[model samples]
Target: MNTYYYYDDKFLLTLYAYLKQTESSIVRGLSDKWEPASIYLEKHSLTHKLIDTLNSNKINPNEKFDNIFYKAYLRVKGKQFITSNEADNIYILLKAINEAIYYKKPQIYILGFLRKEIIKTSNKIRTRISCKKRKLLADNVEHYNQHYNGKFYTIEQIVNGL
Candidate 1:
């Protein structure tokens, strides 16, 4: 936020509330189109080059994915929402962030206090959908997170593989 770079809106700050980055503003971004990779993200931070695909049927953080990913990786992952309720929640959060970043709105109240709360507990908003839909949305999100919209990599990890 030092330079305050943004998307079409204050998408950055709202994103900051979810993911984080280096303050100097030199960033390497990633897309949420991420599939079930290795269990590495749990043991270490998020700096993997290429990852193994998940054999299980969950999207959490373990051999089965952890739910924390849903909150922590929203920029790359937010589009996973299935219901209008979840979609609207994502829309509202993004719009509020836009207002906050551009119009000087309060981060805590508008964005909600805890980042976790914003996604699940605060408003208790859950965009849970069927796994079939989840996979489809994941494909679309990967496109946006990688090509169309993309995002600044808040949590950075150097790739040792490459």
Candidate 2:
């Protein structure tokens, strides 16, 4: 079986810790949702398209983070959790999740510290469900990850990516 890796609460904490250690105000700001990565992307890439897209689309980079990350995680794990209502509005989080997943390797190094946390959450969830229930839950997660939630591109591809 292919294992999936995605950012979760642990990743968040790791990112937070690193930001604290390095005193990198920029990453800190992005983590707090006060400022967005798009700003940095815009500056470095010299393409204001993401910025313009954010402005035009009114994307709130700082949405319900738990829901956003959960949705991303479920998708990668071949599960789903978000309702259609929720997915429709979380463009910023979706963008971030996609960027994070697509550019693995050193890029994901930025998120490494959260590995322990992510593993904890993952194992906890897996353990809480009995075999039958876990199977059902996994199936449902995959369903939501695919159909109801539009956040995931391809269930198979996302699972592979993970």
Model 2: pairs clashing at backbone N, Cα or C within 3 Å = 4-162, 10-114, 11-114, 79-141, 79-142, 80-141
Alpha carbon deviation, residue 112, candidate 1 (Å): 3.9
Backbone clash pairs for candidate 1 read 20-154, 29-153, 32-76, 33-142, 47-157, 59-65, 60-65, 60-66, 61-65, 61-66
User: What are the runs in model 2 whose C-alpha is more than 4 Å off?
Assistant: 1-97, 104-108, 132-162
RMSD of model 2, in Å?
A: 16.7
Residue range 1-162, candidate 1, lDDT tens digits: 111111211122222222222111111111121121111222322112111111111133232223556434533544222233533444454444333333322333433332343334222222222233322322222111223455323222111111
Clashes of each: 10, 6
Task: Find the candidate with the highest lDDT and give its number.
Answer: 2
Per-candidate Cα RMSD to the true structure, in Å, reads 18.3, 16.7
Q: Considering summed lDDT, which 10 consecutive residues are worst modelled in model 1?
A: 22-31
Residue-by-residue lDDT tens digits, candidate 2, 1-162: 332223333222222222222222223433444224433332333113322432432343323334667656566554322223323323343344334433433243444433333333334333322233223323222211123543322222322232
TM-score of each: 0.26, 0.22
